[model samples]
Target chain A: MRAVFWKELADYFGSWRFIIIFAVICLAALSATYTAAQTIRGDIAQTPTEYVFLRLFTTSGETLPSFIFFLSFFGPLIGIIFGFDVINSERSRGTLSRVLSQPLFRDSVINGKFLAGLTAIAIMLASIILVVSGLGLRMIGVAPAPGEVARIGVFFLISLLYVGFWLGLGILFSVLFRRTITSVLAAIAIWISLALFISMFAGIAANWVAPVDQHSEAEAILEHERIYDSVMRISPTTLFGEATETVLNPGKRTLRGVVLVREVEGMIPGPLALGQSLMLVWPHLVALIALILICFAVSYVRFMREEIRAT
Target chain B: MAPPVVETIKLTKDYDGTRAVDSLDLRIEEGEIFGFLGPNGAGKTTTILMLLGLTEPTLGVAKVCGHDATREPLKVKRITGYLPENVGFYEDLTARENLRYITRLNRIPERQASGKIDEVLEIVGLSEVADREVGRFSRGMKRRLGMADVLVKDPRLVFLDEPTAGIDPDGASQILDFIVSMSKEKGITVLLSSHLLHQVQKICDRVGIIVKGCMVAEGPVERLGREVVGGGQNALEVQVTESSANLIESIESIPGVKAVECSGDMLSIRGDKDVRAEVSRAIFENGSLPLHIRAQDYTLEEIYLKYFREE
Candidate 1:
């Protein structure tokens, strides 16, 4: 298994696929950093701050999206490309049977691949985090507080899990389909539904479950929106989106329906502590982890049951 | 007495409704080049998969090197190497890199594996292209690499499924010679599968012909020919320009030659020894002026057609 891991890791790094995908990721990170840094600098000019590092990751200027926003949008592709051809391509190349004949357990192939993918994700994500932090320090002229640093670290881990869920899904498709193109297309199709269209689907389901009646009062509408939001969180894409928002943007007090209190109307706004932010998004984190596990489990079983000889 | 390298008892497999391998009872002796002969889709690959423990049989069991293939596949796999038909490598990695991955899976210590990798590559005559990416390799080169891949583990038994399927004749012969030498030098048993008759006849010490998942015949080439066609008899065809009714008596009178008969302008001689030169000399000296003399040896193809045509 260690052999498979090392070889797969080398293949991932040495291929043109990794070079192209890494280039896209770094460009996205740098552009997001530049835009967020511009906004944070303006904010600093208006009011000096200790959590400028966190603000740089969350803030988006008029012309560019934040780092979290870009990652939430394009991160799945990285995972998809990494895993879309992991198994089917082996079958096509006729290496699957030969590899299985080695002195290794059947599960070792999948285990090694998944571990290699996670390792690559960790390294890529860490590099992006460090690079963006550097840009923030140079642009904002302020270091992050210890609590804010902790929040960023959590944000990085959640991003890894979020991307890992897609990696597992891609591998599942690769095992399910005999053709590499079919697996890649399947991954892209699923990505489209979950990343781009799941909220629309959830809205449709929510409307079907509890329609607002149009003539209903604001209270009924609030109840309708509550179901819609929770329903949208069923998609891992949505879960990761909300989780990162809650972690990266400490000012995000809640993801649920908010109720205004007249007694605290004049109270000043302040960023939530790291622990509070974590508590708020704990469910999303768990859901992402569960998604990763379920995808890996199903793919592993399917692969083990499959006959290695190509028909 | 040492156990057979492979023993299968009533082994069967079904994909959906169609049985691929049905009640196959087989024994492959230790250190012999055993040929598993069958036409396309004749369950040769399915049997190989079962023996390697890459796929489970629907019924019965396969034991390889004393390990139950289904119950202890990892143990069987540890001692077996398989070169699948059209075996593939990581097209992007160098030949040495590809072998390195296999060594790692076998858990050969780094110091040992690196040296073993070079040794096997040299054995396969791939040492010159060790640093070249496999994508640029020819079909024949890839097959050689597959040989190197399987041999890197120093397995006690190697299963090569159509190793020369698409290779040129020279490459095919080279591989055939390599297989013969490996078994001769290291006493490594080989179970080679191919539909080609003459190829298997050249190197296989024993052969099993499978048709529609049934073992139709099994033994040495000569034994199978004798059992299926005639006992201790081979035919020679003599085409003469002049009809010679008296030539039959003259041919039979030669020692170890019998069953001489004349059909039209051709004389058929069935004999134990290949006395084509003497028969030609006899016909020439007898004034028949032999136009063409051909040996009618019963090859695996003729034997295969005789049995396969039955079902």
Candidate 2:
């Protein structure tokens, strides 16, 4: 497995495919961070001073979304790009049988690939985070508080899990399909539906489940929001979006329907502490982890049982 | 005698209700190059996969070096190497890097692996191109790399599935020579699967013919030829300058002639023994001139065709 892992890692870093995809991701991420930093600089006086650095990630400018939004939307693309050809290319190259014929267990092939992909994602994410932070520091002359730094760290981890889920899905497709084109097409289709078009789908589904009108009462409105939120959560994109929102913007109290005033009469109005914020998104984190494991497990089983033909 | 290097009893595999490999009983002794001869989809590759433990057998068992292929696959794989049909490498990495990965997977120490990689590359005549990215390599070069890949681990048994399928005659011969030398010098047991009959006959100590998931014949090439076409049988063709009833009759009357066929000025005689001497003398006795006389030997191609035609 170590052999496969190290080889795959070198291939990923050395290939033009990795360089191009990573460049696109970094350019988009930096631009979003630059725009957010500018927006934060202009409004520093009105924003909470302690969480000013956190706002560098959440504030959107006139033309671009926040840094977190860009990541949530593009993280899946990175994962899919890295994983969509993992097995099928080897199959087409006729190397899978050769590698499997060596002195290692069959599971080692899939396990090694998944671990290598995760490591690459970690490296990519870390670099982007470091560069973005550096840019933010230069533009906005405020260092992040310790609590804010911790939240950012947690956010990085969740993003990794989110991308890892997509990587697993890509590998699953690669294992199930014989041709690289077919596997890549399948993965991209799923990515389009879940990452790009899922919100549109969720809106339609949610409206059908809990319809509302202009004159609808507060109860109907709350029901509609509840249905919409749940439906959106079905996509890892939404899970990642909500999770990072809670971690990066400490003031986000809940991802649920609007609470009644009576229930919040004595509750604190300030941002939740890092631990409390984590508690709020715990379920989201679990769901992302579960998604990653499920994809890996299914792909592993299918690959282990697959008949590898030399041709 | 010592245990066979590869043993299979009643091994079988079914894909989607169609049996790809039927119950096959095969035993290959150490230091022998066993040719697995079959046409496309004749269960040759399927058998290799099952023996390598890449796929499970529907019935019976395969044992490699006394280890159960399905239950103790790692052990079986540890002692065996496979050069898959149309073998592939990481096109972006240098040849040495690709081999380095395999050595790591086999868990060879770094110092030893480097030496082994260089040694194998030299054996395959790829030392000069070791630093070249595999994407720039030709088909023949990739095939040679495949050979080096299998040899890097110094496996006790190697499975080569059509190692020279699409290479030029020169390259194919070179690969065949490599296989022969590896067996002779290293005492490595080889199970070579290919549809190319003459090539298999040239290097194999024994050959097995399979048709539609069943083993049709298995033995030394000469023995199989004798079994299929009959021992001591001769097929002789004689060409004459002039044809007449007298000449035909005289040739037919020759001792050992079983059947006589005449087309144009040629007579094809089937005999239980060589009668070229008597036939030539009789032609002269009949006052006819003999132009040419030739005897055809039954080769693996003929044996393979006989099996398929019978089926």
Candidate 3:
């Protein structure tokens, strides 16, 4: 297990593909950091210590999105890239059979690769967060509060799970498709669908479930929005976006997203307490992890049963 | 007196509706080179996979080194190395790194693994290029590295599937010699599958010829030839530079002699029993120099063809 982990990790770090991915992710993170810092430092209102740290992740200028937004958008690329080729390439190269023949459990090959990819992503996320923290410290001219640090930590975990969900899906595709190129194309297609097209489906489903008739009452319109959000919540992209927004934006009191004035009346203006925010996003976090686990379980079954020959 | 190193009891594996590997019963003793010969789709590879427990058998069981392959695959894997046909390694990694990864996968400590890696690389004559990335390697070098990968564990038995399939003659002969020494010197049991019949005939102490998922014949190469060659007759092909009228008549005088047919410079001497010695002596006595006198042991191809035809 350690062997496969270290080897795969090393391969990930050394390949030109790694260089390409690292460049894209770093550039995105850097741009997001710049825009976020500018938005926070330029704010005229007197911000609290806990809220100031939160602002660094959630603040966005007119032309740029926040750090969490960028992460939720691009993080799947990391996962999709990690998973799309891991098994099929090894199989194609004939290394999978050789590795399996060694003294180890059959699951070790897939397990090790999964663990290795996860570790690499975790390390990368940690590094990026640290970089942003440094940037935050420099731009905001103050150390973040302990509670804020805890929130960021939780956010990181959620992001990792979100990325892991796609990584698992990528591996599933790799196992299902015989060709590496085909798996890659499939992963990209899934990413695009989840990010852009799934919301459209959710919108359609909301209308179908609670059709917005021409003379629909205000309550009917409110119901349509609620149904749309519920449908959208089924997507990992939506879960990730909603989870990060709730974690980083303490002002976000609910993910049910009450639009009616009556439901918003009791909401506090301050950022939700760390515990409260965690409670709100726990289901989404669990769902993201469950999706990852399901993908991995399916991949294991297909890989174990597939004939280990050069056919 | 020792139990067979590999024992398959009515092992069967079916894919969808077709039986890829039918009920095959085989026993191979320790330290013997067992050649598995079959045509394409003849179940040689499928049987190997099942024996290694990379793929489970549909019925019965395979035991390698006294461990049930299906139930205790990890135990079987620990003692065996597999060199898949057209072996592949992580192309971005050096040969040494590839072997090191296997050592890690096998969970050998670095202290012992480093020494073992060097030893295997030396054995495969890959020490000079051990630090070169595998992608840059020629097909022959990659095959040698594949051997090194297998040997890192110092396994008691190695399964090599077409170890010399696409290599040049020199490289193929080198691998053949390595297989011979791996068995003769190290006392390692080798279960090698190959389409190169002559090479298999040259090195294997025993061989099993499978035709369409069934074992049609199994024995030493010479014995197999003797059994499969038609009419239980031994033939001698003698080429004489100078024609002598008395040569054929003298050879025909021997007991068990069937006929002596001459075509140009070649004399085909047939007998119900071994008579090559008597025939060679007859040629010299008749004052015609026998430029080439050789017993017609059917080539492995001929024997394979004969068995395939019967099937």
Docking class of 3: medium
- Model 3 lDDT, residue A197, Cα: 90
lDDT tens per residue, model 3, B1-311: 76689999999988898988888999999899999999878999999988888888999889998889888988988899898886878787789888888887778998999999889999999889889988999999888888878777988999999998988999999999999998899899999999889888889999999988899889988778877884567888889877666877878899989998999889988888888788778878877778998888877899999987787
Question: B1-311, model 2: which lDDT tens digit per residue?
Answer: 66789899999888889998899999999999999999999999889888888888999999998889899988988889988887878777799988987888889999999999999999999999999999999999999999999999999999999888999999999999999999999999999999999888999999999988999899999778866875557888889888888888877777889888999998888888888899989889888889999886678988988888898
Give me the overall lDDT of model 1. 0.86
**lDDT, candidate 3, A1-311, per-residue tens:** 77777778877777676678767777777777888888777764666555677778888777888888888887889899888998888888878777778777657777778888888889888888888889878877878888888989998999999988888898899899989999999999988988899889988998898898879988889899888888888789999999998888888887765477887788767767899998998999888978988998898888877777754
Candidates ranked by lDDT: 2, 1, 3
> What are the candidates' individual DockQ scores?
0.68, 0.68, 0.72
TM-score of chain B of 3: 0.92
State each model's CA lDDT, in order.
Answer: 0.86, 0.88, 0.85
Chain A TM-scores of each predicted structure, in the order given, are: 0.93, 0.96, 0.94
Candidate 3 at A291: error in angstroms? 1.2
| Colliding pairs, model 1 | none
Candidate 2, superposed: residue stretches over 4 Å from native? A214-217, B231-297
Q: Give the per-residue lDDT digits (tens) of candidate 1, residues B1-311.
A: 87899999999999999999999999988899999999999999999999988889999899997899988988998899988887888887789888888888888898999899889889989888899999999999999888888888889999999978988999999999999999999899999999988998999999999988888889998889876886668788889988665676777788989688888888888888889888887787778888888877688877888886677
Q: CAPRI verdict on model 1?
A: medium
Which candidate achieves the best TM-score against the true structure?
Answer: 3
